[model samples]
Target: FEEINDELIYKKDFDIDTIKYAILSKLNPKYLGLSPEVIILEL
Candidate 1:
């Protein structure tokens, strides 16, 4: 993800949706059950 951030910063515009999808797709299943409060705090 750091690599992605560095590459995106080099480019003009960053696609936030792509980053969100990438994070969601790669997150561990154990983390998928986080409560809304935890999720908000993590974000």
Candidate 2:
């Protein structure tokens, strides 16, 4: 989470969409142990 935020902030021109995609990409793999289907549904 902090890493994703740092990546977004570090890239001076990052927008919300880019930040969201980056965070989701990073989280999805780590969160795979949980119910990804439910998570996606909620999101």
Candidate 3:
């Protein structure tokens, strides 16, 4: 997982849901170009 910058957390209008979505989106199989099964196997 990627780390969010401290600057982003300190933003005045930051929303928890938005940050969660951003992190979840990166975990999508299409983004990593790997199948879910392969990901689980590696883990």
Q: Write the per-residue lDDT of candidate 3 for residues 1-43, one digit (tens) a residue.
A: 3338644444547666676557667775566633232221213
lDDT of 1 by residue, 1-43 (tens): 2356457434436566665666677767675765412232223
User: Which residue pairs in candidate 3 have backbone atoms (N, alpha carbon, C) closer than 3 angstroms, thus clashing?
Assistant: none
Q: Which ranges in model 2 have alpha carbons more than 4 Å from their true place?
A: 1-9, 29-43
lDDT of 2 by residue, 1-43 (tens): 2367457434456566665566677674855655443222223
- lDDT by candidate, in order shown: 0.53, 0.52, 0.50
List all candidate RMSDs to the true structure: 6.8, 9.2, 9.7
Question: How far out, in Å, is residue 18 in model 2?
Answer: 0.3
In candidate 1, where is summed lDDT lowest over 10 consecutive residues? 34-43
- Cα deviation in Å at residue 40, candidate 3? 22
RMSD of 1: 6.8
**Position 13, candidate 1: lDDT:** 64
Model 3: which ten-residue window has the lowest total lDDT?
Answer: 34-43
Once fitted onto the true fold, the runs of candidate 3 whose alpha carbons sit more than 4 angstroms away are 1-12, 29-43
